[model samples]
Target: MAKKKSGKQPIIGICALCKKESTLEESHIVPKFVFRYLNAHSFTGRIRTVAEPNRPLQDGKKLHLLCSDCEDLFNKDETLFSNKVFHPFKKNGFDGPVIYNGDWLNRFITSVNWRVLHQDLQKITTEQDNDKPLTPEILNTLSNAENVMRSYLLKERLNLDVLENHIILFNEEIMRELFSHPHAIIQGSAFGTPVIMNKDAMYVISNLVGILVITIIKKHPEEIWLNSFVSNESGEIPQSQHFDSPIVTELRKFEDFRQAYIEGISKNQLEKLQEKIRKDPDGFKNSETYKRIMMDRKLK
Candidate 1:
């Protein structure tokens, strides 16, 4: 593995990706570029994380996960994704279907899934048994998927094997159900985390504004994820998409949580947010936030 010297002192630890006892780099679970775009377009120029909604974050969540070499390996795919899909989709707000050809999209989604899964496992390791429902078999499956993804990211494995990577656009279909709580759907845009549904499915979900990346580890028999699977070589991200799984119920539950959290925001912070929007009416109107509001209004 290649190494680079930095002015800061290196912190030695077991690197999550390469499994090497070497210097680790602070890695973002979701790439920093996604958070950068969210921050740049937000009225306050800051994001409120799900963990601490009151505290504004300057970037996405990060951890001392990957070594420098592994970080470099992930960056190649991140750059491709940010350039080819993320920027253009965010800029136009999915005006039309987007087509992609090559292996980068698959690799990029897998990298994000791997990071989220690794972080989740790290958390679960320290937690008590109160967090039930994860049977030994399910846990083993999850761990195995993580290993497979890590190997795939390292180029040690050629493909995801049985695991699947899906890109579910938060297009008209899903957004329609969320019309009543437009703000929550808007807030969800910046959210990314691991989701486990019953003993049937374990997946990493990244809501990059309008785009939803779902990487599946365990899939239930009845689950039907339509037109969302990212092909190894080529695929099209169409405007119309459908998701038929218990995951949809989980999503609605999260939207309710977000709505409740939004309702609980302190009056002072709400005033500040209002003031920011007030000062930039034209900018706010043209912003993604405004567009989502309009979309919801039309749906209603």
Candidate 2:
């Protein structure tokens, strides 16, 4: 009785939240320690990519797309939400709104809406020159919002009588305007979309830590403005609300943060972001969030 070493052959496919063909595992739509805490002050801590941002960015962007038992059930609700609410909201900088436990905020919003609906169906099957066609009604509203976030992450349960056509909303006031600007310029665009407006939502938008996470498959009236971060009747996400809107003023553009750092990267990383924007073109052209997006694009 001495012959037991049958490991490594688990790579079949189809387990995007127990759909069940089996064995997958390379997940991570937005949980590589939230891009290692948004590239912990990146000069080169990597992690940038609004398509490409001068290449060299990688804290995590995996996507064989889940099955190590659904990536160990979304790494146990992303390690109970990065050790209790994103490391105490980044060690207490955004200074307010932090009360949760609606079963750990519905298993951390069902593992961030099942990793932004499988990273928007793996960016429409790997961006084939993006004509963006993943549509059979956006794949049946992301497969019924991934079976209601996999029955609230494997049965913690919340069908709440058809959970209002599957609702979900979260916002952090662009993480309190990126902790009230600490010498701004942290644009590591990890995207996720599905918005079909007049109702049919799904927005993951965490350009590392500026959190958004919307979901609402089809039921509008802006979901009663996320009814105070829903989850009551003793579930508890009671207080914590600052997500004013207008998409946080288009994520405070500096020409969409220098076109998310010179789009799709590599012309030697767009000449190192055009030589760091020509050695700090006037400290990134005087940022009052780049003079209010150049006076709102010169009054449009």
Candidate 3:
């Protein structure tokens, strides 16, 4: 493991990835580049939390989770993802379907999944007056998934049994539409919050980059035709697919979120909403139902 020069000794704790007692480093749940894009477009270049838009958070949301060795392992994949997939999409923009290396895509998905689980674990352990406790079953599942992903990242494993049956969707139009608004940029609307569903699946919605990585922890549902794309060994993504029911549903969700941030919340209402979110952060962030009536209303 590469060591960094610092005055203070490394903080000793169980690394999230390796599960070994070691010095844990502060790791960003969402990659730093994502925050950089959000801040660069904002007037003040500061990120505001969705729960509390008034409160600005620096360095995005990070926690002391992984040790240096594990952190370095993720960094390697993060660099490949940023260079090959993320940067290219951001620069030239995707006009049609693009093919990605299966190995790299798998690593990217695993890395995001691991981070999401780590963040959730941190919240479950640290938050006050928590409504929900992290169940042993869920913790075990996440830990097992993390171990499989760590092996895959280190080239100790090849198959992605824990992360297989995945569907990655992209819609450049939604991203362009959201980033057009200055308020949306300031609120970090492009960086969609990660939502873990039922301990069976997770969604890492990156509206900024126009990508959605949906991981199936268990068997893929028959109703979801998108699974057909990944059912085979080949990793070719279509240039465009018909806006099926799922696609429409997801796009509408993004639209609702896009409009919500573009239409700023009032100071008084924001305070109340913040309080509600504080009480139930996961519920508030993960709500799928969008009230169309709220579109007409604005903060005073």
Which structure among the candidates has the greatest lDDT?
1
TM-scores of the models, in the order given: 0.88, 0.30, 0.64
Better of 1 and 3 by TM-score: 1
Q: How accurate is candidate 2 locally (lDDT)?
A: 0.54
- Mind giving the per-residue lDDT tens digits that candidate 3 earns over 1-300? 888886977689998777799989988877877777656554344666545555655557677888999888888767876776666765565555556654666676667766775566556657733566556776677666656666766677876664553444444333333333322332234443434444554433343334555444543243353432442233656655322223334444544555664366568756766687688766544441111122212221
Candidate 3: give its CA RMSD in angstroms.
Answer: 9.8
Clashing pairs in 3: 97-239, 266-299
Q: What TM-score, to 2 decimals, does candidate 3 have? A: 0.64
Per-residue CA lDDT of candidate 1, range 52-168, in tens?
Answer: 667888888888888999899889888988887888876666677768888889999988878888888877777736847467877888899999998888889788899888886
Question: What RMSD does each model have against the real structure?
Answer: 4.2, 18.2, 9.8
Query: How far does residue 262 in candidate 2 sit from its true spot (Å)?
Result: 18
Candidate closest to the true structure, highest TM-score: 1
- Candidate 2 clashes: the total is 0
**What local distance difference test score does each model get?**
0.78, 0.54, 0.55
TM-score of 1: 0.88
| Residue 90 Cα positional deviation in candidate 2, in Å, after optimal superposition | 22
Q: What range of 10 consecutive residues in model 2 has the weakest lDDT sum?
A: 163-172
lDDT tens digits, residue span 124-182, model 2: 66673346455666666666666666767766465533332212222333333433331
lDDT of 2 at 186: 31
